[model samples]
Target: MARQRVPEGPPPAPAVQKVSVRYAKRGRLRFSSTRDFQRALERAVRRAGVPMAFSAGFHPHPRISYANAAPTGAASEAEYFQLQLTQQCDLDALRAALDESLPQDMAVLRVVEAAPGALADLLQASVWQLDFEGVTLETITDAVATFMDRAELLVTRMTKSGVREFDVRQAVLASDVVLVRAGDADGRDLVRWTMTIQHTTPAVRPIDVMTGLTELTGLQVPRSPLMTRLAQGILEAGGRVSDPFDA
Candidate 1:
């Protein structure tokens, strides 16, 4: 064989653009594991033909990062992730493309150019809505009073690392019980408990609130409450929450 020459190709472009996207997991998909959601999102990115960036190595992965993923089996209106792109993209068009590619319930809610600061740091707290049936406002009100009054409402949680104990009340910024409805023929009234809580070391969950209520006032929920995260962002000193994108 004779020596031959080959043409060189253009150099790969750099990943200079960064974007942040907020999405929601609702209905049956709320039960989807974090890994499951990650796979789905990866597939959606491919389907949408997004100019995503990859790591520079023998085995490269997309430069997509998730922040504060809602626990499996919980629904959320605000979930966020960051994506690195090889080329600039219109935020609105990117949002539309992702919304069209993803499942209806798991659609993207908003997309914004990545700001200067870290996205995770901006999200310091969450506002959660916990729905309960067959629970009266009187019971919840009394429990709330006791929970807020206590200096430390300690609770135990078993994590992957190990069993840890923390005070759930300290993480609770503010809480209130709202009456969703009076009652129906069955005598089950719809009620919702909403609270703004900080993201502490061992984060406090809605179930933890239920646990604290039962521990403090002996009040019980007939069934598992529907846990939904309404919003998440920087919880200000004045108790107002600002969206991460705004910052």
Candidate 2:
């Protein structure tokens, strides 16, 4: 057949801009899993009448992307979600709407237009807080210091795929492990601390660190781990710290 010429078509229009909502759940709500949080938010936003942007093709769902999925039974003060909308809306409106619909434990902190290509694009580090009881602050701090000072802190993780060896010290950026008086709970002082951690493959959870600490001490760590992701730094084009949002 003779060679036939084909016409080129113009590039597709840019996708609609969206906003990333930074929220948190503490106290009882903190125990909710990431999936639960997603569902709760979808309902709340739906009731708020936020024009949800659906995905193209089959099985369309609201274009809501959570920055990092928090593990179940963990608590977070800095959970984030990106909500794509059909049209732009007021930040205050979205915030207020979510506030009214959301539970008391979960609250929206800030609503701002997401940066171009910033959705899960820039992930630097995370700040986590762990709480426990009958644990000395000095011992915990010392252990954390040891863990941070190490050149390589390796640990084993048993995933469904299989067990794997990983270095935790590499992922730790800045951590402030302290034993704070977490107020009175049944007439007993509770131990709490905040840990600034870096995220990497085979993500290291606060619970994992706590478990390691327990293993190191062999003192039977009390008060199961309650993790809260305090902040997620920005990851630039080169994985460098660009314009980071300190949450």
> Which candidate achieves the best TM-score against the true structure?
1
Q: Give the TM-scores of the predictions, in the order they appear.
A: 0.92, 0.80
Report the lDDT tens digits of candidate 1 across residue range 221-242: 7988889999999998866677
**Alpha carbon lDDT of each predicted model:** 0.87, 0.70
Compose the digit string of candidate 2's lDDT tens values, residues 79-121: 7778878787888988889888887889898888887676565
How many steric overlaps are in each model, in order?
A: 0, 1
For model 1, the superposed segments whose C-alpha errors exceed 4 Å read 1-12
Question: Which pairs of residues have clashing backbones in candidate 2?
Answer: 122-235
Over 4 Å off, model 2: 1-15, 177-179, 182-188, 235-247
